[model samples]
Target chain A: MAANNEFVGGKVMTTLYQHGTLALLVPGLFTGTQTVGELLKHGDTGIGTLEGLDGELIIMDGIVYQVNAMGQVRVVNADETVPFANVHKAHPQPKIAVEDASSDALKQIALKELKTENLFAAIRVDGEFSQMHTRAVLPQTKPYPTLAATAEGQHEFNATNIKGTIIGYFSPVIYAGAVAAGFHLHFLSEDHVMGGHILDFDLAKGNLQIETFDNFNLHLPVHDPDFLETKINAKQAMRDIAKAEN
Target chain B: MAANNEFVGGKVMTTLYQHGTLALLVPGLFTGTQTVGELLKHGDTGIGTLEGLDGELIIMDGIVYQVNAMGQVRVVNADETVPFANVHKAHPQPKIAVEDASSDALKQIALKELKTENLFAAIRVDGEFSQMHTRAVLPQTKPYPTLAATAEGQHEFNATNIKGTIIGYFSPVIYAGAVAAGFHLHFLSEDHVMGGHILDFDLAKGNLQIETFDNFNLHLPVHDPDFLETKINAKQAMRDIAKAEN
Candidate 1:
């Protein structure tokens, strides 16, 4: 059943479809078994990392894009693979106008207005940002390093006075290891030239759309041998991966 | 998509469909929002608890049965609601012959033979048992007490030289709060005369069938105001509810 099906009465349910776990990636299990094309079938809006943990992934309007470590943006091929991702079918929700909201401010607004503390919330913001901080990791070769180590060499940049859409998900603390515990957001500019894993941002003025999901579909990888053999220490990974706090 | 759809090749995917979270029940929220009829639509077999913490629920062969505090067996009404449940469509798997195995041994075999430590595992055993220990709680009226407090008054019994089926699920440690971290099982007699939440068992020889799932569907209830307002402390519940450990 879709996300809305979890509730009674006539309502549009949106399932938060996720492929792979952040825990697997923490231990350097970067090889992907699910392709981009297959992931798009589950949702139109989402965020994740590409195969090899090459770059940040942004899915908007059913199109997949990759933001490289050098802050380069490119449309990823449909056949390209992904190591981890979270996606959902976007249903139209009433947009609330937000002014000069910080990252934490947005979280508070969602909790106070949408009442999404216990549930998973899908958020989208379309407007100009006063400042945006983001980072992306380089593609690794065979014998991939742990995500924490990979993140150490990430390319961080600042984009000011830019128009973009914020795509993100808020996971409950219970899913800390399986996914990032809190807000994990990514940004994509209108020009499709700037986008990456968002570190921080100041929304000048934006129309914030929030959708709460009552269902979560965690799709794990079966083909990857590392995923099977690895004793995932996600709690350890969560402690080590500081960037996961985004 | 079905559980098998998560994998690339043609392997029957078994999706572990769960309604409500173990965390929600921690704070004494025993109101059933999802009906038994609604739960069975997602899967044919499962285990759960009834509203008001009435009894242990066992779903086998598409039939729902409740074992009360007195260890009495009765068919649950289709409209009867459950506070928590885990179910999956059973795709026939090669059964492994297990002989004179304890509860821990069954887990070991599942790990060695089925390799289910990292994945969600659905296990079923049909055979005779030398010793079977189980417990069930009485139905609580409104103004329900917390699960830990209700578990204190549980009725425990021992059944020796009995034939029954063990229905259970193994959740990874990452899901400790949402579901039991380890094996959570329920037992039902072949004659449908005896059944309850399993504490321990000694199987003489049985056909142990295990289905590993790559997908986990966590369906949350939206109608329950308690679920929305309550700050669920599942970690606290996990520490207090000793019966959660099988």
Candidate 2:
């Protein structure tokens, strides 16, 4: 299924040397019935020798050494196993946080714009909105209100469509589940920053999409406070640096 | 990393269905805010609704539907999820009595041949090894044994390297451990049969290598067993059936 050696069927058996050095052994070969003496003569050049038992051993090139009877050999370079204490250990700091506009700041901006307009509509960062963290602009046409009002009215609004852009940054994370989680962004500019909770993840693509929720029929404006601030600050910093260099 | 999707610098979201169904939806363009009611009046049909509580309805084209707060939509057709149950629950048959050829039977055959020669081998018919089940003949090499002692002073009896061919049938099984254990056969004539236990099986390539303790070396004969057996047995059966018909 996945292009990994574990799932596909190919394993290498290796001998762990006492010096913390390891050797790459032949893949899928076994040391059967042969004694320690006999195994030594099988052309192994490694410093280790087979223990006196019926267990398995790894014979890479010519060197032969004992392995756990039950263990299967992995086909990787000798140095690969050095960092792995065991094959199953989890990685530390497995996720990287990507910067994004704050949700609260975006809501504040949206609420301010609504108040200025004297509109009574409620505003929220709708997680249910598909464009919440994407470059995709909200669709021009609205179907929900039409469906709510009448079946015939729904059809008319579908003719002309509205579109807006959602923009944000993405963070990366390690996947421990059978089904991988999609990528999400850290709201770096938000007053109440949310971190480490999975949002808008995709397993297959192994990426995250981040954007503002300014599009669609919602009452929010195209400008998000944090995003606007980041853009302005970036532009100002670039100008100041250029003047200093001059 | 596996080159399945195009690389994008944003958050990635993917939806996977039970039976190999996958969909990728991304945010695009939104021009201005329109109520769900206003957008639905356009009479377009690209809109879809998700099923759940707090479901916010989405309008695409002329259609309107709700998306639950969870940001998940189950768009799978009814027929798709059925085959997943069958594939997940399947289990192969286990080994049983007829499948069990005792170690004693192998020992008896080995002992009988060892009386005349230093080593003896036999391949038996059962399980996956039966000709009725698998017709594929695996490539096998002869065991290279080291010289132990001299037969006579003048003439040295060198340790012979013997490789065998597919003559009859034999089913191999793992006895003490997860490793495979069994013997392969090389036919000599109509009455004489020889084989040995296989020490290595390559599941990926379907190749088998057997290690026999005897000195006799054999290869597969030119005579086809199926043709010969059919000619001999079909004659008698055909005659009996003819008489019954008469």
Query: Best by TM-score, which number?
Result: 1
Question: TM-score of chain B only, all predictions?
Answer: 0.93, 0.14
Query: What ranges in model 1 sit over 4 Å off?
Result: A1-9, A241-243, B1-11, B241-243
DockQ measured for candidate 2: 0.01
Instruction: Judge candidate 1 against the unseen true structure and give its global Cα lDDT, from 0 to 1.
Output: 0.83
For each of the candidates, the C-alpha root-mean-square deviation to the true structure, in angstroms, is: 2.3, 34.1
> Candidate 1 versus the native: TM-score?
0.95
| I-RMSD for candidate 2 | 35.9
List residue ranges in candidate 2 displaced over 4 A: A1-88, A93-97, A101-246, B1-95, B99-130, B133-246
lDDT tens digits, residue span B1-246, model 1:
223233435655558999998877877889997999989888889999899988999998899999999989999999999999988888788989999999888878877875646789888999999999999988998898887788888899898989999999887776677788878889999988888998888999899998888789898887688888887664576675545444
- Over B127-170, each residue of candidate 2 has an lDDT whose tens digit, in order, gives 22211111111111122111111001111111112222222111
Candidate 2 accuracy as lDDT = 0.19
